[model samples]
Target: MNNLTARMRHGVIGVLSVALFTLMSSTAATATDELFGGLTSPHEIDLLSHPEIKQDIQTWRTDAGTQVLFVHSPGLPMFDLVLKIDAGSVRDGDTPGLSALTVSMLNEGTKDYNTDEIAELFERHGAKFSTRYEADSVSVSLRSLSAAEHRIPLVELFAEVVGKPALGATQLQRLKGEMLNQLNDDNNWMPFFLKNELYAQLFRGHPYAQPSGGTPEGIAAVTREALHRFHSQTYTPQNMVISLIGDLALEEAKAIAETVSQALPEGPAQPPIASTPEAEPEVLHFERSNAQTDVMLAFPSVTLDDPDYVAMEIASILLGNHPNARLTNELRHKRGLTYGVVATFMPFKAGGSLQIKWDVEPRYNEASQALVSEMLETFLRNGPTQEELDLARQLFRSEALNSISVNALAVRKISAIGFNGRPLDYIQRQQEEAFALTPEAVRLAVNRNLDLKKSVFISVGPEVPQEPLPELLLITQADE
Candidate 1:
């Protein structure tokens, strides 16, 4: 059931207005920006119900101080609920893996249900729940039918899982053993190693350096007492946001939100992460006997709040992220060096990293490294071509529309945005804003922010000829 059929023709394709940075939109019969509140001009004659799709969102705060965001989706008799808590690795304090260990115990045993009993409850009701922790937040999600008989008991069990847990030393040891085994297994996986090492190197003393999953030493240090205390302090209503989307009336949605929020204990929101210091540029190499070399070039980045964020996102797509972007055209298509290459921009709250990562056969190590550097330099010097910018905008717009194409996606996306303090309509605005992003704007952003001298180069694989890598010319302000 694709619902955006009319919207696609009007709002989605209208992004072609960027036509080589000239506002020549020959495709749209009439612009659909008017559909959005104050976002566009509407013609009185051609009033359409759906120019672009956006979910109807209702928001409020519970007595427990949890932010509740509800989307009244009228379709399947089901609901997707997500609780985004502010207790992640950054809040680990002196104990690095405390958050991960804390969440691992949520369903191990509740006040009335043991691990097996909890699993059976979910299966019997055809409900699902999952817990995940990342650098800045922990998410507990549920998918269950909205029918009163199923939803009522499952919601009760969920409340118990989150609010009343029985922590035991034996359970602690078993979970620790499992985490340690995973760490041991992943030790030799070079890509994982590179990511951990890069963050460690880039933010050595900051909490950002801590891995979301605990290290072996940290996992071992986690005790039953520590888990209990951590849970009490961090998993509280004040620090949480609830996202509920599915078939339900406003009153029913509000009742569910209250139940979930009121079940949590009261506590204050945690403090912000400390200021992240800038990382100095360096060249690093790690030794391993592998068939190919994995290379990464990283430049420090500002947060999403930065004005140039959208432009940089476009630059990442133009550089190597897109299928037919410059790097793929040069390395994979023209030279057949490797099957893939990717450019990633991490938009951390404090600061971030713009990294281009690729693996190439050992024989082409130096050639590939020089080629990557050359391509980056050329992009910084001249910026993305008109076609590249237009294509990137087209792709971005498509992704934004597709974001809410289903219930689960909308629930997760809206929840994340609400938790991160963005407007519910941010996605829709981004889709419309993509059309206004010009190539010159992207060029200025890339030139100002993506300096090679500021990037740290890292390569991991068996040693090859240690040829000095080519030097990149610094793009001057005048270059833009």
Candidate 2:
């Protein structure tokens, strides 16, 4: 062997000898007689020791509809109950933000308690009651300690919040005034613009793309009667899931759930979601006078059930997984092109977006676009190398080690199960499936999904140079 090769081999051997000696000496030091046996480091072989999530989740039905029950531990003096109504933004029709306002106003007044009385009830117990809505769900929560004799009263208060929220006209006008004034700021306006433009580009004509927050114009039209109709029709037990945790027995929990369900009217089934276009590529551009350029690039990539979804995730990791990731290296670190860049594969109920977004100096717009294009093109043709794939797997393994908390893992597991409509075993299954993704599988995913020719680019920046700006078809948000 040549001198250099021999020297390299000797260096490796020396390092291994040192590591072995350290391990032996550490083991010897740890071995000692004690009142109790000394322990070795906990077994790394079992990286996942998830809490025993006994999904003895029980269900009961009242004259109203079904109620779901699960045991909870609040570690406090009172019992907390949550009822998640499936009345979401989709039910608001074209009226944006109505669902959010409707939920928030639930605790503002009931037949027995005005807004002040309701707020004071919680303060008396050092607890809280709240209601809010999202695009697909609305949640109501009550918190108190276990030893408190007021568990049943807490249940009744929650029922009142759901059943008889007085949508006072004066209150409606006040909330609308506050929301309208806040929408003109750059941060607030930017988030709305981003969500609306990106989803409209992907899901086009779908209600999912509609604003969940009632628009200023829509909120202006909201009347007390309209909110009443919305409340009576949407909040029902059949469309709801109840979860109670902390200091309640199964029988008591069931009784409380029954009382909450009895308070609501038996509403009609939610209407089917309005049809959305298949996630095809469409270019959307927007203009704003900002100090820094903002950009978002997206393509509809995968659903929760797609077989290649795991490979796509792994590919995303290699593309923008770290400071040394291929995109970061080419676009930011090597070329000093931008502040930072990200590539993410967001798997959702249906197909979702494989999104790459960044902010860069306006002067480098042409170079930034070129670098993104070339990186994607190269990924499509050749994919990641074996060494790159190995490093990515190591990085993902390390991340899993860090994030395996009981609560965090539980949320991840439950969300995956709910979103995919799959069994709870789905998360455990991901560990094996994600690691099994072959390099060729990643290559196929990239080639199939990452189409440079037909993809959307949303840029909110100063003027773009003419050469790069005209290369892609552009539709400004102002027109729509």
Candidate 3:
């Protein structure tokens, strides 16, 4: 490695070691004082002084082709296991929500147990089982005591649920009904409507445009056979990534992985999703009866694996990642056009987007939008000051460390490594990159990635005169 790289790594290690030592000594002292004084309440540790846990991931492939990432967290008597499958909403094909429905039904029932029985079994063993579905992946998480009696049964049960979901006709009907109800309910929420519209406009014909839970009509049309077929195709050993973190030994973790992998059917990974098209710059207004106008300015952005992702991330922080961000400072603090404003980057497996969103009074919609546009133009042209860059770096570093502090979040990071096909040290590399970012790098990233002419502006609120907003390209009434 170069001298600079060596110095950076050494600096990080030195800082972390000193912080850890200080925290341990302080904590011990505080506990002793509390014991003598008879204080029952706990004191908060200084978060800034807390050390970041270095990730030590042990990866290997099971005989059945399932990949495993294991981390031994020795102190805690509890463990977390995450099974991530490539079967997310993007894999739903024409039947939007098929992937989600199939994943949701995993714990509902297996060949040996019904939904209630499954729930009872886990609860009886002091274990928790839950599933999460995202755009590109679906994951099931299990938290259980590390004792063999508790962990073994739960692992076996999880394997059964993943390998052989019943997907009964009645269960399918019930879930479909619930999903439809949710879709209907979301229609009345302005943010939900605006988000869906913005995604649809940005992604257009892409699968990302399809809602993960599907529309009411789509949900109503899902059948038991369809769910079963999707399950058979998507929930396979090769398409899954297993992550285990807890007090278990390496051998024990391997055995658990073997059991789960052997239970799954062998199949190839799902095909890659088609790329999303570049967004066309346009303004769309949806008329609702709401008193406040919800506005979203979005543009296409780099993916997580993109070389420029770190720079884009820093640029986003400078824009509005924090309370003191430019958007909040100008739009809320100075102009008082809105209560708050935020800018964020949403990166998917195949694509991503950057969005600035806020709400304003109906009368201030035009002025607020104009101001936002002007600020964005200026920001892109001049870039952020050194102060902004330093603040963004510090905040990003703190947040990154905090994210992995908890067991659950650390487990999720393992899953992200597998799901995104990123390296085990991805988080560490990201921290290094964020700290190394410069003003010129961020400016280049902003100019290269963000194109105002190719962006989309979407607003949902009460109808207003169009003459005041020359940027308006399309106006339509929101669905009732």
For TM-score, the strongest prediction is 3
What TM-score, computed on C-alpha atoms, does each candidate reach? 0.85, 0.75, 0.86
For model 2, the superposed segments whose C-alpha errors exceed 4 Å read 1-64, 67-82, 148-150, 186-192, 305-315, 347-351, 385-420, 445-454, 464-480
Which candidate order results from sorting by lDDT in descending order? 3, 1, 2
For model 3, residues 348-403, the per-residue Cα lDDT tens digits are: 87899998899988777877778788888998888998889888877776666556
Model 3 TM-score, 2 decimals: 0.86
In the range 159-222, model 2's lDDT, one tens digit per residue, is: 8888878989877888777656544442245545776678667766665665556567777777
Please report the candidate that would top lDDT against the real structure: 3
Worst 10 residues of 1 by lDDT: 27-36
| Model 3 CA lDDT for position 315 | 82
Off by over 4 Å in 1: 1-51, 466-480
